[model samples]
Target chain A: MDTTQRTEQQRSADRRRRELLEAADRVVLRDGPQASMNAIAAEAGITKPILYRHFGDKGGLYAALAKRHTDALLASLRAALDAPAERRERVEATLDTYLAAIEARPQVYRFLMHPSDGAPGEQGFDVGKHSAPVLRRMGEELAQVIEERLDLGPGTQQLARVWGHGLVGMMHAAGDWWLGERPCSRAELVRSLADLLWGRLAAAGDKVGGPGF
Target chain B: MDTTQRTEQQRSADRRRRELLEAADRVVLRDGPQASMNAIAAEAGITKPILYRHFGDKGGLYAALAKRHTDALLASLRAALDAPAERRERVEATLDTYLAAIEARPQVYRFLMHPSDGAPGEQGFDVGKHSAPVLRRMGEELAQVIEERLDLGPGTQQLARVWGHGLVGMMHAAGDWWLGERPCSRAELVRSLADLLWGRLAAAGDKVGGPGF
Candidate 1:
């Protein structure tokens, strides 16, 4: 094809892919991590074989959908992290940003981070394998930011990376439990987590007539 | 059967089950998370059917294996947490205990926590589903300890629960990454993580000629 025709075809193909991804997302929203290929294809008004042709398989489709959401969530987190504020305010904002996202679209968050939290069986892709990379990616991205911005002396890079993964993990585990139990309000969770980052756990006194944690 | 005979039979059955589990452990150590029923049976000097008879299925076997490792790991962690030391010392010791366990037996840790880290398709059970509950249990256990020991005042229980999960998560994620990369000595990892919990991140200064983290 001529260069202009090829360019036109590429644009159309990209648009079609985006449309397919949106359909897949809707299915995930409804069915959760157990979203099936048949359901997605039907949602998009396409046949199963055609859907496979576009995305390769369930794993491929999942990767694409995860990327779309992870990218968006990361962008919001970046904004929160980069905002001009004191360190504590920025930390709370970032925590709130993550909690708010997960709180709003828990299904998507579950799909991306805890696919196996859904009822199992009939899933063809390796759910655990896929979900972890998203966390690892977020951890790595946060590590880069920490390394670039913070003045951790001596082995700054290594310390930043460790803190990056450590912070992400703390957020994820806490958020996952919070989502399940709703034990406290989102503000409380954010405040509690920021307090943790700020070292209140160390500062707290031992309960009277008891051994300390 | 007589009561004494029945009791003897139960004790023998328990012994047999433990033997089978030990065999399974050996196979898992050799083969990582993909330790198959056939391999386990062979290791136990038995057939596949016999292995199934004991554990019900791959999922049952996996649960048993996970519980064994988790119980042992938790015991060590409890010791570290309960040791009569300063809070910082206890925290470092706890972090070190976990890291040491994972470093010494990465394969077992991977099998329990990241079964999908191994090659896929051969796994019959829901690896992700099983692995997460271990972390959840650890988090809850830690939360209880924090709530009981720390005097945070007012919403102390809820805050303790949040920190419980968050701290466990931080340890897990950092340890997981460190195990894979060996970026620093275990001591350094422990200190950095302890520093993180002690509010070093919030106390850190901005890098010269750059925005702060």
Candidate 2:
């Protein structure tokens, strides 16, 4: 085929892949990880054969979907870290960005958070592997700020781990609950969580000698 | 329908139900909630007919298993609450009991904490509803302690919710991460959690005057 035809074919395939991923997200969110490939293909407005041609199978489709979201999420986190801001401001902005991403694509969040229940050899994607470096970088940056602001001892890494996990788990639970048929606004939910987390951090700092000064 | 025969039949049925529930737990844990009735029956050393005779169907069996575990867990919580101890000590004891229960039955703990991805109307096996009242009672009791010890006004209920969810989430996450895996003993896990919580409460009280004192 000529270069023009080849490029056109590649673009068509890329669009199809993106469409399949979008449909997979819908299926997983609406029906969960147990959603069947036939259902996903139907949702994508494609034939099952075509879906198989693009993704190989349900497992490949799910993995590609996970990887796409994980990449997007990490990129957002990196952007949050790179933006110039005060320490507290950066933390808050990063959290807000994280929360917004989860809210917008709750299925992606659920896929990452829950254990994979798919067939053997179809282990659900692992965000921990993808997100660990981002977390480490965030921790390193936050630790430096913490050291400059507080008399953090050698235990800062442990503290950061605990704090990071606590915040993540807190947001996850709150987001899950909110996703249920609840009556709270996102702003209210975010504020309640931010207050609980920031309040605890502020208290920790006060107890540990008022942030280095 | 003689009394002796009737009693024997009842005993046999009870044994079958127990076996089925235990098998269901194993199936759900090893395989996700989608484990088939045929698989569960095989695991229980019974034919499909006997499994059906015992529980009617898979949903009924799953619900029965969930209800049974939920009752046992709540009973443990009640026992902890009834133990004669100071208020703070009682809370600590309750935390320990909760941790132990989760540690002992990690699979059941996971099922109860997170909703299953089963058919619609199958996710109501909520241990949280059963435990929420117990938590509310503890919160009220703790409110009295806070009233006597701290001067925080009108924030007791909200604070209790925050503290309650935090402690529960912390312990649940710890159980998920540490059960059969972590180097820390249950006692150490409980102590660290209790200390972190109570330390925060004490410091918060110091910041705002002692409530109702």
Q: Given the true complex, what DockQ would model 1 score?
A: 0.59
Please, what are the lDDT tens digits per residue for candidate 1 over residues B1-213?
A: 499999999999899999999999998888776677888899999999987788887778889989999999999999998999988898899999999999998888888787755665534346546888889899999999899888999999888899999999999989888887899999999999999989999899987889543
Regions more than 4 Å wrong, model 2 = A1-16, A26-34, A43-57, A70-151, A181-213, B1-16, B23-35, B43-45, B49-56, B77-96, B107-152, B155-159, B180-213
TM-score of 2: 0.61
Candidate 2, residue B6: Cα displacement in angstroms equals 11
Error of 1 at A177 (Å): 0.9
Per-residue lDDT of B14-53 in model 2, one digit per residue for the tens?
Answer: 8878878888788878765546677788888877888878
lDDT (Cα, tens digit) per residue for candidate 2, span A1-213:
599999999999898788788888888778755566777888988768888788775546656776677678767876774566654455557667776887787666656654343333222332222222333343344434333333334544344334444344444445544554343566655554555544442232212221212
Best by lDDT: 1
Task: Summing lDDT over every window of 10 consecutive residues in candidate 1 chain B, give the lowest-scoring window.
Answer: B119-128
Whole-model lDDT for model 2 versus the true structure? Answer: 0.55
Q: How far is candidate 1 from the true structure (C-alpha RMSD, Å)?
A: 2.7
lDDT at position B200, candidate 2:
35
Here, model 2's chain A TM-score works out at 0.56
